[model samples]
Target: MAHKAEDRTYDVIVVGGGPSGFVAAIAAAREGARTLLVERYGFLGGMPTSAALGPISPFYFDDEQVIQGIPHEFVQRMVADGGSTGHIRCTNPHGSGSYLCFYDREAYKWAALSMILEAGVTPLFHSFVSGVRVEGDRVTGVSVTNKSGTSFYSASVVVDATGDGDVATLAGAEYVVGREADGAVQPSTMMFDMAGVDTAAVKAYMDDNLDDFEWASEMVAVHPYSERLPRQHFVGQGFKRLVKEGMDAGELHLGRDSVLFLTTCHPGVLHFNSTRIQNVDGTSAESLTAGEIEGRRQVMSLSRYLIARFPGFENAQLIATGVQIGIRESRHILGEYTLTADDVMSGRKQEDVVARGYFPVDIHNVDGVEGYGEGGVWAGLDDSYDIPYRCLVPARLDGLVIAGRAISASHEAHGSFRTQGGVMAIGQASGTAAALAALGGVAPRRLDVAELQAALLRQKASLRRDPERAREERRRAVQAVSAALAEGRISAKYLADAGTFTGQAPRL
Candidate 1:
């Protein structure tokens, strides 16, 4: 095949069309950049669309909802299309607070694609960014492969949103893989949906069985799991509690015609992310392959369990599986600043901050103990800390900006930053900053801090300052709750949800 040279240059070329890349392309184009988005898959919305993920996880910033910029618009569109419930659940992550929203994956994908088209971004699907072309200290373009073989696309700025930092590492950016010393990384889960579930029957079943913790414990103990991450028996019951509260408050109606039914949706659809693959290095292709294989097997088991044990699900079937490997760990590109776990716990603000991660440090480990059985614990700083612009700037790499889960941060901090909601936040800021840097004819690191902050604000990003004050406020709240827990002033369950746990002992 003969490769032909094209005489076109884009103002911005974004690699990896996941949550981060999709938002990056929209942000850049909205800022008046001629953007081209390249995705490895056939369509957009990396994990959510391709992998069939449900909802936007870890989406709130304290009581104030933080995911309100470009991503919010995409979500709203999905809700309006009758594709999602748009239910925002506020969870206390080990006493730390977080928000999650349930969304229809296909609806969200279409919404993202619509945004890109509306913003005039040229999306090249089924294209993989294989290599980066560098000239002097600046990245001139990227090498990509498609059905047409290898080709080059030149751009003034490149945003790497491939959750694994594929483009960044290929561009010679230094990065860290997995955890140091402890050899722990968040466990990966393959989410699957079940259908033919009767919502009312499912709710009734949970109400009757959630208190049967002993029975669940015995069953899970015998379950063939390679890792022993504490499985919470009360998660189903907890949701039942929430439902009761909603019904009492008149916020949720559970009747047959009610669209807000708990388990039943469209007559037969249920989603599960129960396949847990631990110690799987997300960056290594071999490990990822193994995880995928195991994920499929786990989903098959879950399908059997649902059919045998649960009501409504007896007729339910596993209709779909995630499109890509649900990777929970990957490379962390070293930047000018390494965000520490302490920063996240204290909600430390920074003068040079470009974005804030309000989600807790949800550290998921293979040997991690179980207490509540939901997700991981949030031991990070109170409130949220700023993600310094430097974290996105790959160390010693010019004109290359790393976005999404690959940004420089401690392993603990990565949990807070790796959520889909958090990725969209960082992606918007990084994309706009990259476009501005390209226009200014300077490397992303060399761009003026004030200018970058101004650009971020213009794009409606909630980048904060004054870390010390935020830290003090959060510290006071945490201390007050810790004292209450110590004196048995509050229920342990409540403390766990509010993120107020203060012991080496597990909460369960």
Candidate 2:
């Protein structure tokens, strides 16, 4: 049963109101394109708001700030609401200077909404993108269903940011699902919020049990059942192994255990973005439904555990659950170039690099993989890499650009580049490229790289091509550290500390 089509048209249409769609709508409209953003939810902020993820992680690139433009502005506004810190060297047991901030999720949502409205972008909420309208090899419009019924909204260009590549898939774009070799997709998380907690007591527990409570490992074993799950472990040999190296180097803080990514938010209130729901497929409605059901069960159990285990949480209550299941990986539309694990490891910079992602390849397991157990697979490069423009341009699509978790990249690369900060960078690029394509009457895949760079520059993006300045800073840091070692003023501990401090070696 279909209703009458509205046939309302705009210059651009962005589907999904997550990080990518929010930025895409703003970017296109700011460039003078009449844009419409449709979201199934009433409010925006995607995962951060919907999931109640109070903290935003990995906001810096190396020792310097990387993500700028709209995303930075959004974060800065939130930081202003609280007391936001800036540009510190992140290196410790769990990488202290990674520049993650504990924020107000509601405030973030309001800020994102304000930015979109100010850009003069029309946002239609409670409307889901049901079908895409295409003519021949190009996408011309999309059909969205709401309380009114199924209505078509035409557009000159479309950017897919549904995280699962929903719009592009519906629009006839071909894509790949999961991994190729081992059939591994990144694990999904179900975050929750707790109120009536004591910040001091929880922080003390974290310090005392830093090694025994391993949330990632324990959750992988006991989830999909239990309303009273076991407590998360933080104090153990595994955590010790991670901290000993960094603490010894002097490059890291002595109490490096304080920041080992345990599921400990502020004391009185806590956000549980820990439970790893594995083997869930984002594309299938059935699979996603199963994940959601299992996720809620695990969350309830975990919440009960928090009440019983810690001192401050005796009165703690589960106040909120994620509005939507947090998906880590999904259907990726095959693009002009496939980003490989090698590109990320080597920190390769491409001439057509559109956005930069510095987060590590934080892969969770699928099926019966080892995970970060006693001797787990924990390998990552201590640098950021550039995502080329070709990765966002679908191989066969003319009017579509892919952003967020579904951008064309290997499963390994996707794990690293799928954070909120990284997604914003991709969204900015996609929106800018779409606007450029519409103006030039050219395919998004064929836009000139130099011209795009100029536009990005005018927008104050951080992709300056001064290879010499970057090289010189590394050289100076190395030279200074070498001198201290030669003078015997520093021990083997000192040399190791210097390497880690300069970001040459792993934090721990």
Candidate 3:
């Protein structure tokens, strides 16, 4: 059978409809661009929807709401829909300085699709970006494929949110994979869910055994045994002795001493973040296949052990697994700015900081201690660190912007900003920049920085500020916007539900 291939063009094309790509597509379309979003999966929410990577993280910094704007809107929608646990305090044995939103996977997929359609983004699901179209070093479009064969999509600006930097690498962008010395990337895990868990009993057990587990890092400060303890709901109980018993009895395969668990918005259902598959390269098809096999194998043994020993899981049943294995790190495209671990550790600020990553350097199981928490100890972010615009720009490319875990950051810094919340902000910033560049008919490299920042502000993106100074600035801005919102200074974009509004204002 012969298939006819067609070529289509858009002002902006966002590849990889994950946490980053979906937002990028939304922002571009909102900018009035003929935006097209291409995703490999049938549904959006790469990790959250596919992997059941619940609970969006770091919405609050120092326990205050930090990340805001479109992603926040998505979170609010999740909460209102009864699909999420809203915002829960950190209570993981790994430590409790961050917050998470345990959202229902299927609900997230629906909400994401709704947002994408509402933004006027033409979403092509069940298709993937297979190649990039370039003129010299500038990416002009992409080659995509599906069961129907192959096609081409031309765009004025291209946003690479493939997480693995597939489009950027296909466009001949220089990239670093895994760690610098030995080429060992962080292990990718799979998330699953267990239903019919006696969560109250489990919580009671953890409450009684708070002193048994190791925290993610010393940076995470939690006053143990106080009211602040339940915030560790996301943490896996550290039953070192019991885990060893399982291992000694040949019931456990992984070296990790604890099984991760998180509570969901739905009662009696718990999110399971176990099954760590290390040393498998996500970029390799063969490795990923083996990893999935091993992950599934582990899930069975782990689940059996839980039902046999752990409380609340005796009647538990395996309900879900991620659409794919949860990939933590893959390729870091050499961008205009490579954010370093020191930058994340020291809480560095930059003049052109467009987004903030409030999490720590959480390297999962690369150094072999265990995959439970951060691989190393680093000072916690005093407030939050800024992700500069240069991180999105490839060092030698034009019209191609990278987002999500693929941004130009050192191996260490990648660990911090790789989470969903951090990636969401990065995506919004990259999307906004792509739209501005396309609208102005200029290379993203040449778009006016101030003008772009102003555009982001109009979208209600929270630009990085001195944490101390932003308090007053945020106070006044919130007051002004609240008053304006009440006095009919409202647009459909800003008129959603009752929530603390962030960002300066939207441009009508």
Candidate 4:
């Protein structure tokens, strides 16, 4: 029942309909490119919709909104639709000085589709990019398989926003996967939602027993628990004692030690991001299948445990789970420039900067166990770091640019920029660059950075930092670090290891 269709051509083609791909397609089309967006799923919004993830994070660094343009516009639309609470201050102790945008998954799907369509981007849904047409060092087009049968789509420029570098890999681009030392990727999660929860009871219980929560003491030091918990949107992570008791009695099989929950705009519905599936390779179907199965099992166990023991959850019901397990890390295509851990930690700026990452290095443990030898690593940043255009341009490859989590970065750096806000900004940059390159008849690497930056700025994208503010922030951070050292809040070894912030070359 398969029929061959005539090959379609476009000025730009973006594969993947996630955060990055969605924005990329819209940006390309708005820039006057005949753009096409291909998605494996029938709908868009990527992880937030398909993976049931909520509360998009790192929209702000300190007091500044570092990520803007198309991503911000999408949020505003979602807000106007009553699908989101807009951007709210993050109260989580681990992610201080950040903001999160909470929205309904169903709303995200419709909003994304409407925006892409309004921008004149052609969207091909339920189509998988099975292969790419490469001539010499450039990718000419992609071969996709859908219900209509196999078809070839030619484009002047291609954007790989697959979140796994699928197009780049198919086109023979060099890439790396997982941590460099051990080759182990971050653990995956299966996010789920529950309804019929008594939020009042839960909040009261947390307020009374703040000592039972992880980082509760630190959070309370700044913002009181009562003031921090919003009725419509709340995020809490803690339940160590309960989880331990469940594990001891063989009632829980999940690896996580704490329960992470986020409240939705709905009265009593809450999202749970507590399920952890370990050692799952996202690129392999077999591995993903196993991970998904395990994740569902964990979700069931977690929901049952919460209902039986947790306050206000006695009558809670598991409403829905993610369609698939959420992969935190995957293949990073090697580009002209690889964003390094130093670049992210030092808040390095570059002349060719296209995007800024404000999220901290949040590496979820590769192994499933929590609070063991290496449960996880969360290193906060005092300011934002720049991501150069070269990170999107694959080395030795033409006609293609990478976006989302798969953009070229060291393992540690990827942890920061992989968040939704960071990737959306990156998508805007990559899409604009792709359109400019295709229109100008040049490779993405050969496109003028000035032209790209100007186009992005005109589109309301946030790229440059305020020089005086940046200097003041740096000075404040230095002072804080020194004060911490003197007060014994940090060790001398930690300061030595943090390296100098004086703009000098790092010592061997």
Q: Relative to the unseen true structure, what is the C-alpha lDDT of residue 31 in candidate 4, on a scale of 0 to 100?
A: 95
**113-201: candidate 3 lDDT, tens digit per residue:** 99999999988888988888889889999988998778888999999999999999999999998788987888777777888899878
Q: In model 4, which runs have C-alpha deviations exceeding 4 angstroms?
A: 1-7, 92-97, 216-232, 371-374, 466-508
Q: How many residue pairs in model 2 have overlapping backbones?
A: 20
The global C-alpha lDDT for each of the candidates, from Candidate 1 onward, is 0.67, 0.67, 0.75, 0.82
All models, RMSD in angstroms: 11.1, 9.7, 9.1, 7.4
Query: Considering summed lDDT, which 10 consecutive residues are worst modelled in model 2?
Result: 216-225
Q: Order the numbered candidates by TM-score, best leading.
A: 4, 3, 2, 1
Better of 1 and 4 by TM-score: 4
Q: Find the number of clashing residue pairs for candidate 1.
A: 21
TM-score of each: 0.79, 0.80, 0.86, 0.88
**Model 1: residues >4 Å from true position, as ranges?**
1-4, 91-98, 212-267, 368-376, 465-508
TM-score of candidate 3 on Cα atoms, chains taken together: 0.86
Better of 2 and 3 by TM-score: 3
Worst 10 residues of 3 by lDDT: 217-226
Weakest 10 consecutive residues, lDDT, candidate 4?
216-225
As a TM-score, model 2 comes out at 0.80
Best by lDDT: 4
